[model samples]
Target: MPVSQQRPLTFFGVAFAFLATMLGTTLPTPLYPLYQTQFGFSQLIITVIFAAYAVGVIAALLVTGRWSDQLGRRPILLGGLFAAMISDAVFLQADGLGAMLAGRVLSGLSAGVFTGTATVAVMELAPSYLKRHAALAATAANMGGLGLGPVVAGLCSRYLPDPLWLPYLLHLGLAGLAMLAIWQAPETVTRPERIRLRLQRLSVPTEVRAVFVPAAIAGFAGFSVLGFFTATAPAFMGRIMDVSNLLAIGVVAGLPFFASTVGQLAQERVPLSYRLPLGCVILLLGVVAIGAGIALASLTWFVCGAVVAGIGQGIAFRAGLGEVVAASPLTRRAEVTSSFFVVAYVAISLPVVGIGVTARLIGLQATGEIFAALVALLVLMALVLLRRQRRPVMP
Candidate 1:
């Protein structure tokens, strides 16, 4: 069949595949408390578990970032879905920290592969008329799946037959569906006659450096806030605010991700040069709100902060991504995008570990305040750097 005939069914199919893989990455967010209770671990353990996934992502990215550009998008993405399913099965059988950590690492591998490969695949599959909007659609699917995971998991854990097992089972089913859908979707990359495996290198080209630098910093800061919420916000809700409902915690945890989608949408109205700085400004404000929430012990303040941070992160994230994609050499696009995400996953993992360490020492409230302050500092730095860029990235 002609590519045009396959555009609608194929494009959306790959998008859904992207979403399903991302959903698996965060499926364990709300379930952390359950793991803590059962395993009797520390706050640091939570960060470590989450970080394990990020580490897996970085590892896969280092190995397979450009695989789609060589072996084609379809096969790499199929490998990603298979990884996700394996992670779910691992989670289903998890008995202690080791198994859970292993599961998360596998999940990370899945996300790492998908993050670059799937994003590019969705855009490649878009019909000509929808081309301009395809990038946003891909990003929305990424953030939306991430945001929705905890919510769906929360609900299942709260009311389902077995809290621990049911969510993974449900996701396992979704993974199966996504795989079937993607199997039918057309491959966008032309397969080379000779396929050789090469590790992804981690350097930015000279031209992309200006945007890459600020974008990585902004991405780091925005993702730091997101990491905190996903890893430990439930602890705050349960301990600081006295909320015990799993559903509520999941919903709150997901707010930033969903808000990020909104931010991405709003960036369409922003000028090419102003988007990153504006996003940093919004992110800094959100950090303040989060600090306020921590100081006052107000759930309302915390929720407000999350929404603001999400929006800021979304705007900055998309802006940085757009600039990088635009600036990259055509053949090396996926590789460069992978390098960017390596920074992001690093940001998501390390800072949250710091939160765990600080929370353990000074307690959650003071620790949260300090985290907010640190994030704000990074955002300001990014804003300054963005202002100093010599050449504007042209789309």
Candidate 2:
């Protein structure tokens, strides 16, 4: 197909593949409560299980982060999809806590590989006539895929006869289809022979340093919001509020990502100077609502807070990412981007683990209040920094 003709299919393929990878990541969201009951684990262990996936993601980003740029997008994506398939298999056969952890680890590995590579592929595959659409493809595939994951898994778990088995089974089918689509897609890398296997050290170079510090901190704060949903929110819903509906849980978990998508969509209208600061202010509102929900033990407050905070996370996260990507030199784009991801994943992992600790010591509700306060303070700091600096004129 001509480049111009490839837009629709490229968007579909990239979006489909992106969602498949994220579905593998969140496939276990609604199931965490089930695992707690089945394996008789503590809440801390649930947080630990989620953290294990973050470990896999960070590890993969550090070691093979730029492999796609070298070896070509197709092989890396194919491997990612295949890894997701194995992860689904692990979930399907999970009988113990170890198997569940193993499945999550593999799922994270799949996501780690796919996130960066598939993003570039989507951009590269855009039709010549629709070249400008690549940005939308990349952003939508990312945030949209994340939002779709829990929704898809949640629906399957609620309606399907065997909740655990059926969700993975459905995901397994989706992964297989994604794999087929990827395999048949055109190879964008021209001189495949020049590519070589190499390990990447995740580092922020001198050139990226000036912009890297604030950008990374902003990313950390934004991703911490995601950490709340992916790791702690569902447990909060069930344990504190006594709500146990799988679909409802999924919706709550998905709200931030959906809001993030909205943030990205609204990016064009919002000035860069305003995006981060305004996003932080909105994020603070979310933290407040979440804290309120926990204190009052009200599900309504929790859901509302999630939507508001999610919009903030979406706005600030994209702006921070855009600044970093735009600032980095072309040759170092992938490495720098991977470093940003490393920072973001760490934000997601470490904070949630800390919350688990606080929940154990103080109480889940109390810990939630503390977490919200800390995040709110962080956003305030980001805003302070934004105000101190002069705005750069956009090209």
| Estimated TM-score for each candidate | 0.94, 0.93
**What's the lDDT for candidate 1?**
0.89
Q: Which stretches of candidate 1 lie over 4 Å from their true place?
A: 1-4, 206-208, 325-335, 390-395
lDDT of 2 by residue, 20-75 (tens): 78867876777788888888978888898888888888877777677886778898
Any idea what lDDT model 2 has? 0.81
Go through the candidates in order and give each one's C-alpha lDDT.
0.89, 0.81
- Please tell me which predicted candidate would have the highest lDDT against the true structure: 1
TM-score of 2: 0.93
**Which regions of candidate 2 are displaced past 4 Å?**
1-7, 391-395
